[model samples]
Target chain A: MSFFIAHTVHDALTALSDGARPVAGGSDLVVGARHGKAPLPPHLVAIDRIAELREVHHTDSGVIIGALVTHHDIEMHALLTTSYAGLADGSALVGSPSTRNVGTLGGNVMNASPAMDTGSPLLVLGAEVELQSLRGTRRLGIAELWTGPGRTCAEPDELCVAVHLPAPAPNSNSAYLRLEYRRAMEIAVVGAAAAVTLAADGSISAVRVALTAVAPTIIEVVGLVGGTVADVAAAAAAAASEQATPISDQRASDRYRRHTVGVMAGRAVQAAARRAGGEMIPVPLNRAVGIGAAS
Target chain B: MAIGWWPSFSVPSGAYVKIDGDGSGQIITGAQECGTGAVMTLRQLAADEVGLRADDFELVYQDTSVAPYDMGATGSQTLFNNGRAVVAAAAQVAEQLRALAAQHLEANAADIVLADGVASVAGTPSASVTIAELAAQAAGGELLIGHGSGAPPAPPTTVGSTCVGDVGMAAWVAPQFSCHAVRVKLDRDTGVTRVLQVSAAHDSGTIINRVGAEGQVQGAVLMGIGQALTEGTTYDDQARQRNPALLEYKLQTCADAPTVDISFIEIATPDAGPRGAKGLAEAPNVATPAAISNALAQLVGHPVRRLPMTAERVWLSMQPAEPEVAG
Candidate 1:
């Protein structure tokens, strides 16, 4: 019932300290309220207008995307589209145009939907979320943020401020792929993201693989980070299939999710290896891979 | 058509038309226009029969007490059945108007030809009176009203209980046929599929409203694509709908719509109600899913025997090994 538009990071934290729920974009929160998915809090702090939270600037360490940075912003950002292409691919596949324009990355990371398009890519990119409160601030790896579907570990008084992604090394690039029945505005039935570093000989020097909609959380697959492209692809696919603990639901059966997750993981690795070799695979791998029209 | 007595039925449609002091008329039918253009079609039929421009007649509907009984707008019955009622009622009204005009012109009612809201002697074009003049004279106590009811003709007694021999029974008032073809692109790696384009051909007897009928097919094909790929209800373990909201139920967006090409073959069937026009409301939706599925089967060289044929399902169908092998 009460509202405040925070103009700065300090003002947002001040409102949060008063138990006002910080709302950036409110795409998820408003939808949840409309559908009665969750009770609307009595007090709301509008953090979308906070100048600092809308920043998308490179730091000495890496790229910093403010919490208010929208999915559309990430999809069209010059630097992220080039360096963190996997995340950009994931961003491009998020919801639809209106959703991408209004749905912020902070809401996606904090809402913690299991089928989120950006989760697996962020995991592969080694992204971290910065949570601020009146008490102080803390950073947690993307993988450590989720407790379950629509649940996150951050305290109610803590507000997500930004996402930090360490820059990719030379000769490294990444890709994300998701299985959708339609071309636009879909939750991934199953998805995979791979960040690959290619050696001069065109073999995968290192890689990190993550699977979405396969488990309670976005899961990282190991042991395929260092191998030839073919070898890494096969291992990542096998590992993802073995590790996936999906449950049967209407979107997909557990068996189908497990199998397709493996396929996507392998394809993600293949695409990432190609990108690492200096091929410019576009974001939203579906459009480039025959599922949608090319730009 | 074979002669077998199937249960033949008629849909009761009621309509009332009022010719005002002005040259215009008003048609009141109980049919609801749920975006199928029933009101527009009714207006066109009534206007043509009453010898007025389509824009001169306005239509009002859905006031049950004020308007006559109509068998609602479902089953594509609005145009075929209610359309008959309006035309018949307006035809009667036109007859009366011609009779009045004939009296004034010193001609027979049969010799008076009605066109452009004017009643004139067929041979003597100058001997004519505008509908507005006659309507004004008939106002007050002599209100000009037209009423009509329409239904399908009864079946012949020879129609047996069962369709016998090689003959197909034609029990309904109108029969329709349609075909749909779709082109799709399948991503083998991610199991994602997008409908690139769709073409639909329809034989809905006669075409009454060309634009309305074509728009019907276009909308139906898009909805069919949703049913074939993304639209479904999910239930929780407790027998509750899990994804009751539109956000989760996954209806197709504008971006998901494919290029649509529509064609109509107007073959006049005698029993197609009033205007040789058949009911085509649900016809376009009937064959789309099967067409899309067949296209996918041809694309992947595998049977797509599932509703929605999601990328996960298509991908799993393509895999030779089972998930237990990985487990």
Candidate 2:
């Protein structure tokens, strides 16, 4: 049977220091019950009741997103809209309202699926994560924390506390596009996010293309292509689908998933560049269109 | 029930009438309605016999344990076959009452006529007495009670044994077709098809209740549409179903069902059925799946065979160009 325990803790950090797993909302954890992949820790800790970790505050350095803050909260946050537009969009498409209302940001990152939506946009925003244990607290880069799907670099007793995203530069924005089948409730088969900044000389300055579900981890294609409206979309698609290893399963064949990643990557690049409107673009997911096509 | 002619009117009391001790009269069974109009037809038969108004009398159809045994109602046969028995019984009871009136009035039997539940004595309006009055005088003698049955001819000269011959329905299955029209929409990217409209035309052969016939037709259409778009227990190459959980095994939700309109053209088929009614339940849903698939083909650019044209299957059929949108 799947074991469940819920209680407020006197010392939140110490409760999890003895190999206890902390749960805010069991979205991905419960889904693993069917496959029998879930490991039931002898001791369970409920951290949502702790008032100290439930606040979202902004600082001169960056924005501090409370680990308990849900996808719904982040989607409507004004600070992230103009600065981290793609992250907000990605959060909106996580799942239906029911899943979003209960699923927390810390749980999503800790679960660490290759197909995770929030991962790519967070990566594009240059985000860092905080993990706490009885010993103390240590900050780790998002890239360093994720080892692979369902396998994180954090120790068994460690719990992710907060995620910090650095504010974007002037005249810069990002966008995310998810391709799926249905309307209200659906998982992204492939997702791509890009941020483009334009220069004063009327040419591309910076670009970043982040892709999910194409590989074992969320990928950021930095120099896949140049940041011009002409090349942004196509370039991202090619780069995202490249250097990816996916196998065929019941959902779809491996070939279709790769092709989808390429298309979405290109579309994401175009979207990010459009938002930049002539500033330094961090990353641009360029679309191929007719750039390399035979006339 | 279809009322057929009663040929065996050999008993002098073959015509019909039901007389009550009181002015009120009860219609004996001249026909069996089953679920149709048997009650109304029998009431009409009795009201005319006793000169009472049609709406004035109430009916009671007791089982064989209390009421007289009947040949049983089936085929459109109740009114024609068993009607003769009840009609003859009522007429016999009337005849017996008239005979007693003639004896009591000291008049010839021919001169005694029944009018308004009474014999017209001396052909004068004020001189009449009720049938109950005459029956009361003849109470010590035989009480008037008539009982008989009706039957079609047995095997005689020109006939052959066939399919319906065993159950007497051989000439019945003349073959028929129910027509349906459907409209649907298809999403090009995902291959998801939506049902917009469904209309059906059927012939339930002389429908007694319009509401009942239409309900059956609509129910069948909904079942067919669900089967065409989604349903069936599938197994993989290793005989394992990938969707063993209830969430994965998709069924039609209430939101998915479309509106249905059913129309009927009742052909007078007295020969086809006992009361000109034929089997309609099975025929309605028979060809619906094929019709839906044809509609989907128009929405999409190809024919969809096999059931449950799911999103994945539809996506496979309409593959993306270059596998990417922008690039």
Candidate 3:
């Protein structure tokens, strides 16, 4: 078995060319190994030490977050909190403190779990990933990048270098919400994220809604536009329920996931609209909606 | 009919207490801690009896080769049985120290008060000898060692033939009763339930150490929450267990812990235990699942009877009855 500490993106790709798996926090890969889910790859390239893959910056086109940015970083990043609040909220809800400290956006996206907290937000945000190899760099939309549960379309020799998020338009914002049996250390039984742009008339001019743990991949709802927040929210919720193709498993039954994802979608749309309208609100809308037990 | 040997009917246990020349002591027993704070409780009991600070004593436990035979640390029997042995051994050492001090102070052994490891004459404050001085002589070959073995007295021989129906009120030793009340919030949409708070009342005879007792109660209640809400083994159609990993068979996390309030009602059963204390380790866990289920049933307006009332099951229970179908 051979190991490589990639000092640059080129080195990481070179290592991957020899059947080495790229590991950036290794929270997921190492856990899989320890739990006997799978053996560790014979060769591994540690990409976390690469200085370039760890940057989050703003450009004229959009805010670019390096793939290695930890969930803890996203949860606390001031830029994500302002414009991409849904991604930040989803980041905050990822795993426990230890997992959040070591789990990275790159690993989460690459792992391609349908229940990924960041998946729905990235889907709604129209985020794209920059995959690099020795040959060159290629960009793919987040939705196009995933093929199935734990299977991504990215080639073995390609490494996800960064995530690109378009700048939130004027009077636009996003929010993500999920239902869990517990308050922490949970994969979303069903989740929803919404990015809405409000018209000057205080109505939703344009909106994108996405559901997690409700399909083979993050399911983005189409044809949700132009309505009062309540009308828009109800439409989005019902649409998501109809669009969801969840399966019954240990975490939740298909019927429950379908129904709950709809509810979460409705809540996400309303919350995103509220944020787009410039109202100060907390994430995890259950706390604000007074739905559960008072904390 | 004659009574034959009942293997576990009366558990045999032993403990050894040794006070060193420097006043520090060790209590050796075969009881296991199992993270249930048994070691701490034993230390407290031994310290109180020997008139030494709990911190001043060290415990050697769960070593079969060194320590005497115990029934092992099951059924919460460590504190109930082994604790009695510890108290007995420490008392023997205290008595010996008092006898040695009585000779030095020219007073009666019974009148030599053992307090704070100092043996003082009852009426004379100035006449005293520290446990260290007496232990120093013992360490120098004076031969002072305290040992004790404990077992319940033999039972009366059976008189009648093997009886079937309702054999006159069955004898129960160290009975513990506990009631758990919980408040839960059930999300109707997702079927997710969160335990908000748990309040427990226990009758575990006399309390040994309040802090350790509370810890036991709280930990048990948290485990109870797991049993009620999130813990289960899934099986496939072929009768194979599907989820063998920790990820799939979810246990309660710190975030799932609810506020717990515990109160103890002491009704000392002197004949049943040492210091009238009963086995509390299992009592607190027994009633929690029932209480949580009752709360969930009330919240969802349906009797949701199931282990690990997972979100899916609870949601299914909340659904309205389907329309009658024609045969």
| Winning model by DockQ | 3
Report DockQ per prediction, comma-separated.
Answer: 0.43, 0.05, 0.60
Write the candidate numbers in order of decreasing lDDT.
3, 1, 2
Off by over 4 Å in 3: A284-295, B1-12, B151-171, B270-272, B322-327
lDDT of 1 by residue, A230-281 (tens): 9999999999999999998767778778878898899899999988899888
State the displacement of the C-alpha of residue B47, model 3, in Å, after optimal TM-score superposition.
1.5
The DockQ assigned to candidate 3 is 0.60
- Candidate 3 lDDT at A237 equals 95
Clash totals in order = 4, 29, 0
Candidate 1 Cα errors over 4 Å, as ranges: A59-61, A292-295, B1-10, B22-24, B96-141, B156-161, B164-172, B185-194, B230-243, B247-250, B296-327
Pick out the ten consecutive residues of candidate 1 chain B with the lowest summed lDDT: B1-10
Docking class of 1: acceptable
Give the clash total for candidate 1.
4
TM-score of 1: 0.88
Per-residue CA lDDT of model 1 for B1-327, tens digit only, reads 001111112467889988988777889888788987886788888887767888888887556888988878676677777887888888888887888888889999999888888878999999999888888877854677899986555533455466542133434435667777788877776466778888888877678788988888878888887788777776666879877777667777787878889878788765666677767666777788778888888878977667777666677778776432110
lDDT of 3 by residue, A104-167 (tens): 9999999999999999999999999999988899999999999999999999999999999998
Window of ten residues with lowest summed lDDT in model 3 chain A: A286-295
Residue clash pairs of candidate 3: none
Q: Judging by TM-score, tell me the better candidate of 1 and 2.
A: 1
